[model samples]
Target chain A: MSTNNEIEKLRESEERYRTMIEMACDAIFVVDAESGSVCEVNQSGLIMTGLAIEEIVGRPVWELFPEDERDRGRELFDTAVREERGRRTSMHFVRPDGGRVTLDVTTALMRLSGRKIVVQVCRDATERDEFERQQARLSQYYERLLDSLPVGLGIRAAINATPKIEFENQTLKRMFDTAACKGSGITWDACRADMDEQPRIAITDDGSYAEERRLANGQTFLYTISYVRDLLDQWCEVTIVQDFTRRRQLEDDLEQVNRTLEARVQERTRELEEKQTQLAQAEKMASLGSLVAGVAHEINTPLGALTSNNDLFIRAIVRLKKLLDTSEVTSDAAMKERFDRILDSIDEVTSVNKTAGERIKNIVNSLRSFARLDRSEKDRVDIRDGLESTLTLVSHELKNRVEVVRRYGDIPPINCFPNQINQVFMNLLVNASHAIKDKGVITIRTALEGGWVVVEISDTGSGIPKDVLPKIFDPGFTTKGSGVGTGLGLSIVHQIIQDHGGKILVTSKPGEGTTFRIELPAR
Target chain B: MTASSNTDAGRSGTIVIVDDEEMVLTSLRSFLTLETDYEVQSFLSAKEALQYIGANDIDVVMSDYLMPEMDGISFLAEVKKIRPEVPRIILTGYADKENAIKAINDVGLFQYIEKPWDNDDLLIILRNGMEKQRLMKKLQQKIEEINRAYGELEGLHKEIVKTFV
Candidate 1:
């Protein structure tokens, strides 16, 4: 009764094993050890080979492999029986329709019904192998794309605890000395140590780090380091390097060009200002020339009448003297009295004419010295001469309205163009006189400083405003009303003084007064 | 002085002077009258001087170059028309010397004198001008007398020819 129960239990166990094998996702094969023939196969194995169970049951297992892989399949089957276990390997199986499929196979030694056999299990690996090959191709494409770029690119991957150089593009290798970089592996610490002398590392707002390095070869490079997740979600360090030498050279050249252009613009502006000043001076000279002609006519008219009167006096005196010397006229008291009355009248007339002649002479002399038309060359002249003549010329403008006070100093003569210097004095004196509205005083002071002759002209009249003071020496800057001033006086004065290697300065108060100070070289 | 004395002894005529300025006329008249025996007539207006010249005999006419009514050139030109034998002189200022000189030939002027002339030079010019006028008058009188004498001689020849026939 116990033996019958044991047989029934064994049959049930066999059926359970068969059901488990048929339900498995992988294909299962049972091979005879001695004959290397297929003894059993699962439904998955039959479906994988596209063969009937009858055709595969007694056939050699190596026959199911492709013709080229049959030998390796047979050796693996024999090794499984001899070694009792076999490693997993990939093998190609041929279907009866001549199609092929890749499979991952594992074998083990087994004993069934007192016979030694091999049990092999294989899984369809076609899709998995194709996916892995695609992954490899994509990785190689990415590396080639990085190597084609001008900018150097590299990657360091952390494995376990140490960072290892996982990838480096061709550009990154060419940018640095490969032999030196190999000796000291590329790491953040190693790079920092390399730039110890001039360490420049900047952390950006985005948490990326950037560094600039100048090598011993005078090559400049910029590096940007970033951390990112790679394909397998592992932490990686990415570095990008760029050469900056050409960009720096271009910037320097542009700066040099800009400086030269700025200098040229300033020089051109100065030349244009000089030309404008010369044109104004020529206009002034033309007006003065016409004035000279009018003055000449004025002098001639008075001169003609005075000369005739002088001759008349000479004749009258001689005739009267002759009459007085006559004996007949001396004896007659009546004749003598009449003669004396005529002599008295003649004496009064001569005195009046003498005064008029003196006036004409003085005016002619003043005009001659003021213009200095005869002296075309430079002359050593006292400054007082110019001041006096300028005072004479501007006296008509200042008379009755203004009073002038002169404070002269003892100074050596100066070598200069007397006419231009005289014009400067005239312009300043006239300007001073015009400053007075109803009544004021003009004070002219002169002194001798070291190597310079200083002349100060001050007016006690309406003064220039502080805002208008700085632009007073610029041409066409005028405070006077229209048609009253030409506005070129101060600028002309400045130009003439500068030509003589001298200086002019002015100080003014709004309501108090204004003063013009001039310094001329005493050479 | 010697030239003045010489002119004073021989020169005598009615000298007419015209000027806008009274002082100029007075000065010129005084110098001429005191130094020469010639009779001097002074007028301020050129028109008035022309009237006087037309009525009387004058040896020389002197006029100032600038005047209100007429310039010296035009006034002298009028004088030449009235008395063709009179010598005209222009007195001008230095400023008007150029214009005066240009008008001298146009007006048949004997000379132009700049203002404030020297007394001796004035006397010499007047004496020479008067001599030229005197010679012109003498020449005209001699030509008239020769014509009359020739007419009488021609009448006598006609009468003698009638008696001989």
Candidate 2:
């Protein structure tokens, strides 16, 4: 009964081995080691070779290999049989129909029916090798693309209070070459400190952002940072840095140019306004000149007739008297009385006419000289003459209100436009006259001081106030009643003096007097 | 020249006046006739005055400036051409002073009197011009008489010399 049990056990073990060989996923086959022939093959082995069982059972294993691989295949089988060892190799096969197969093969020596045989196991490896090669190529391409980027790129992580620089591209490596910390192994804390502001990068947000920072070396950087989840699902910040100093400097220069251009435009506008004012003043003076010429021409004719008529009346009366003296008209007491009455009446008329004619003549002469109607050209002008003419023109206004004193010194004539200079004198003299209340003294003094002819007009009257004196020559500045002054008189005087390369100075004590001194170039 | 005598003082030489204004002409003629002892002739136009001067013996020619047909300066210049020895006077307005000065320098003007002139001054100036003109004519007559007498004496001397030789 024990012998029977042993036989059954051995039989059961052999059946289990057969079943295991048949069901193995790998192709298992038995080959004759000495002849390199296939002795038996499993169902999987037949399917792997694409062959029938009769064609594979006794076929030489070398026939299954390609021509070039048959020699190595035979040698591996022989080595496994003679050395009683197991061997493994990758074998290339050519099927009967010229199709190629690549297999991972293992040959082991086995005793079958008391003869040494080789058991071969093969697994198809073409798909796995192809997959592995594709993975290697993809990784190489990705590395090359990362190194060629323009902006410096870095991956950073700060976890559990330990900051790490996980990956830095080739651009980052080159950038760090010139940085304070000259390596790619940089911490998040170090990078944050290098930035101009705090909170260098945020990984909580999933979108991209940009920021600008200046370094200690005066270099400006614009960094664009984006959040990325790595393969381990750990969040990190990706930073892209660009130098933007040159662009910022260009913008600043453009702004400065705009400011300068605006200032120049304002200056040009002011200059044009000043020129326009000068043109208006010149036009006014020219019209005044023509008007004066017309008045002078009109008045002189009538004045001549009136003056001559007075002379004629006086001569006629005298002639009649001479006749009476010669006793040619038969004189008597009554006739003599009548002749005396007529002579006295004629004398009275002649005196009145003479006074009236002289006054008219003086007025006409003043108007003509004050206008300087025919003196447009710059010539040698006597400053004293200008002052005298201005005084004469305003004599009516100053007749009883002011006493005039003339203290004139010998001075050379100035080279100037007489008309404009006379206008200045007229403005000052009239202003002096108007300043007096009831009765005051006006002193006009002239002198030669260094290369200049100086005429000083001083008035003992209500003087200009200290607060008002400085603004006297500004356009539209006036202290007089609105209709009493156009306010352009002193400003024009000042402008005319400046145009002649001259100066006017005023000194005043309120309630005491005011003095205007004009200096003109003598040459 | 006729000296100023008591009897002929009111009836002396003739004075001609040319003026555009009738009032001025009448006044001037009346004044000259009454005050001075000169005969006066008046004309409204310078052309008429020229024609009258051409027909008559005139001692002085007075003309007003700014006339219609011809101004005083031009009229005086024309009168000087007609009678070189006659004195010319201009009655100018004050505005015509520049033209009057030019006339005096260019036309040998004896004098220029502004309008509404003094009667005494006009009479005196006219009397002087008339006296000067009369003296010049008399001097010419005397010179002619002397030349004629000398010619006669030369003819007698020549006859005597010829007979002696």
Candidate 3:
């Protein structure tokens, strides 16, 4: 009964071994260790080589491999048999259809039926090898792409606890001192030490964050960081840094240039405005001068004729008297009496004519001088002369309407353009006369004050309005009705005075009087 | 008139006055005739005056400046070309000193008189011009008489050379 039990146990053990081998995912085969011949193959082994059991069972193991791999296969088999343990290797096999199968093979010495035997279990490692190679190639491609970026790129994992740097390109490594930046906590320390100011970034639930930092080397950078998961599904951060120093400097320089250009343009505009005002004033003065010259020319001719005729009449009367004294006409009382009467009458008429003619001549002369037709040259002129000439020219307007008062002092002649100075006097006198309504006093006072010659023209007429006084010297500013005054008179006067290195001032009270004070340098 | 007529009529010299204005012309003519021993002739245009002067023995030529057709300086220059020995005077209403100096230097003007001139002053200028012309004529006549005498002497010497040598 014990012998029967032992036999049954042996049978059951054999069946279990057969079932395990047939259902295994790997291919299992047995070969003769000395001859390197295949003894038996399981179902999976036959399927792996795409062969029948008969075709593999009695074939040499070297025949399954290519000619090149036969020697290596024999060596593995010899080694396994000597050691009495299995040895693993990987090799390619050729099937009957001329296709290739890559196998993970193992060889061992087994004592089955008291014969030297070899067993091999081969798993199809082609798929797993292909997956590992693809992964390696993809990683290399991403490394090259990151290297090609203009900005520095780096990858880090677990920034808080036991921080680790997984990957870093050449640029990031170079910027952070390769050895120091290889890890996480050290990289943060390097970043802090390199920045001039504290980096500005706010960390929230991770997506992306940016920091602008200035380095101690006077270089600026913007760091853009993105949270990502690597192929292994581990959380990491990607940092993209861009240099911003040069661009910031360029922007600052542009702003400074814009400000300078704007200031220059405003200054040039002010100069142009001043020149335009001076041009308008010059035009007004030129036209007035021409008109005065024309009037003076017209009046001087007739006056010359009248004065000459009067002179002739006087000469004739003198001749008649001489004849009466030297000739025999003295014997005739009637003739003598007639000649004396004629002489007396001629004398009275000649006196009156001479006085009137001189007055007209003086006015005409004053107009001519005031016109200043040839005003290219300046002369040493008495200020009083200019004032008197201007007064004489405007005498017609001021005759009965205004009383003239003169307070002339002993002041030296000033070196000046007489025409311009005379123009100033004329404008002041005319303005004063116009201010008078019905018989008011116009006082012209001149004196030497310090290093200046001062002329004060005052009028007791309707004074300038308080609000209008400040702008009286401004071009085109006038309170007079349109077409009555050009409004450039006082402006021209002010310009002329300024051009001569002088000053003009006005003091006026409404309904009281107005005084124009002109100060000219004495020299 | 009486003073002028009392002087020797035959000795009185002739004068020419050129003026554009009729009144100025009449006044000058009357004044010259009444105040001086000169027979006066007047013309309204410079061309007429030049034509008359070309045919007359004028002692003094007085012309007004600023006239139509010709100015006083140019008229005087023309008279100088016709009778360079005649004295010229310019009368102008517009007494521009530059024009007067120009007339004096270029036309050899004897006088620049401003019009409506003083009668006595103008009379003095006219008298001086006539006196200079008279003195020049007298000197010229004396030179002619001497030339005549020398010609006669030359004729006599030639005759003697022909007869004795």
Candidate 4:
């Protein structure tokens, strides 16, 4: 009765072991240790090999493997048996349908029922291997992408309160000289210590900041550091370094070009202003030339008549002397009468010549004062003198149509360019003369007031119109007939007054008259 | 030449002077009357002088340029039409010298004298002009005598040809 009870318990325990083996996810095999053949296989083992129980059980374990993997399988089995220990290896099996599967096999030597056997546990490793290979390829591609960037990139992390260079791209290695940085561990703080000047860094609440640093090797760099979470979910700093030397140089070059262009434009403007002044001066000279010609003709007319009369006087005297020397004057009454007539003729000639001489002297004096050619430089001169000379110069134009009345006052001389002042007066006087149609009167008045010499020239003629008054001093503005006046005259007058530090004003009534008032500094 | 001898030698022709200035006319008349025996006639207007030249036999005509009635060149050109043999001289201001020189070529004038001229130069010019007038008259007389002699000779030749025929 005791032997039957023990046999029933043993069978029950064996059946339970068989059921557990069949329910396992991994394949299980029991091989004969001496023959190196598969003596038993679980349900998973058959499924893994794609073979039936008959095909797998009692077969050589090396034969269950592919042709190329049979040697490796046999070697694993032999090692397990000879060492009387367990062995782990990877092996491939070929199914009857020519399909392949990879497995991780762990073998152990055991004695069951006094027979030596190998227990093999195998798990399919194909999916895990493929996942590991894809992971490796992706890692390689990411590294290459970072290396190709223009800006140097680096990652730093504080592991256990100590900063470490987690990763650095190829560009960052080249920029920081990885060989030299090896001694310092290639941290940003270490690189700052190598610089000539330490830059100030300000980080915001976002844990990202940028700074410019000048290295001891004469390189300028911009560092942008950003704090980001890495793949391991740890915070790290990413630094992007850009060289700023070339950009700064280009900016400086552009500023210099701008400065040079402004200078050239200013020089060209100055040249154009000089040319305009020269043109106005040429116009003034041309008008003066014509006035000189008229003056020369005026002087020559009297000079010719006086010279001829003087010659006749000399001849009459010579004849009278001849008669006296011959002693024929006392003897003949006719000769005495002829002598008296000759003396009378001489007297007449003397009187006419004296008038002509005075006329010549006045004309020459007026011309000299009008031009003031020798006194072009600034001098202390009476404004009245300039006015008087200018009046004389334009007297021919004013002779028939315009009458001039002078109201002189006791005024002091002023410091000025006398020639230029005279020119201004001449232009005004001529313009005043031209304003009249048939007959009119011009009044000139001078006075001294508050350290200024004031001159007023008024004409009773056709005055300037209201519409044309504002533009009278603009260059190339004219009211006179085309052949009669140059438009630059009044503009030149205004310029000359400004140069002398003087002021000019005008008032006009279209039909009644026009008046020009000038105030010059008395210095 | 001695003044007396020069006056005696030039005692023949008539010199007519025209100018707008009375002073110029007076001065010229006095000088001509005192220095030479020739008749000196002066006029303030070129028109009156032109009329005088047409009516009388004048030796020389002197005019002033820049006159109001007629310019010296135009007056002289008129004188040329009436009495083409008359030697015409122009007295001009210095400023008008260029125009006077141009007119000299245009009008076939004797000479142009600038204003304020030397008295000696004037005398020389006047003397040469009168001498030209005298020579021209002498040539005209000689030509007239030759014509009279030729006419007589032609008449003699005709008589001899009649006798021979």
Residue-level error in angstroms, candidate 2, position A454? 0.5
Q: Model 4 compared with the native: what TM-score?
A: 0.48
Give the per-residue Cα lDDT of candidate 1 at B151: 96
Task: Sort every candidate by lDDT, greatest first.
Answer: 1, 4, 3, 2
lDDT of 1 by residue, A1-523 (tens): 7888888899899999999999998999988898988989999988888889999998998888888999999888888988887678999877557778788989889888899989889998888999999989998888889999898887889545667888878887776655655555633225545543484689988888988775443445677889999989998988887765576467667888888888999989877886678676756664564465346445644465575667668666876677676757667888788877888788777877767766665565456567664453588999799889778878899999899998888888999988788889998888888788889999999999998999999999788988899999888888887897778788889998998999999999877889999999986
Reproduced native contacts, each prediction: 0.23, 0.17, 0.15, 0.55
Candidate with better DockQ, 2 vs 3: 3
Per-candidate local distance difference test: 0.80, 0.78, 0.79, 0.80
Model 4 bad stretches (over 4 Å):
A1-43, A54-125, A142-227, A235-250, A294-523, B1-165
How do the residues B1-165 of candidate 4 rate in per-residue lDDT, one tens digit apiece? 246564466555799999888877787777767767778899999999999999999999999887998988899999999999999999875353445578898999998886656667887898899999999989999999999999999999999999999
Judge candidate 4 at residue A253 and give its lDDT: 79
Q: Model 3 scores what on Cα lDDT?
A: 0.79
Worst 10 residues of 1 chain B by lDDT: B92-101
Q: Per model, state how many residue pairs clash.
A: 0, 0, 0, 0
A299 in model 3: Cα distance from truth in Å? 3.6
Ranking of predictions according to DockQ: 3, 4, 2, 1
For candidate 2, give the docking quality class from DockQ: incorrect
lDDT of 4 at A396: 85
- Model 1 whole-model lDDT (C-alpha atoms): 0.80
C-alpha RMSD values across all candidates: 11.0, 9.8, 8.8, 15.2
Best by DockQ: 3
TM-score of each candidate's B chain against the true B chain: 0.92, 0.89, 0.91, 0.93
lDDT per residue as tens, model 1, B4-80: 47355347988999988887787777777666788899999999999999999899998888788988889999999
How much is B120 displaced in model 2, in angstroms?
10
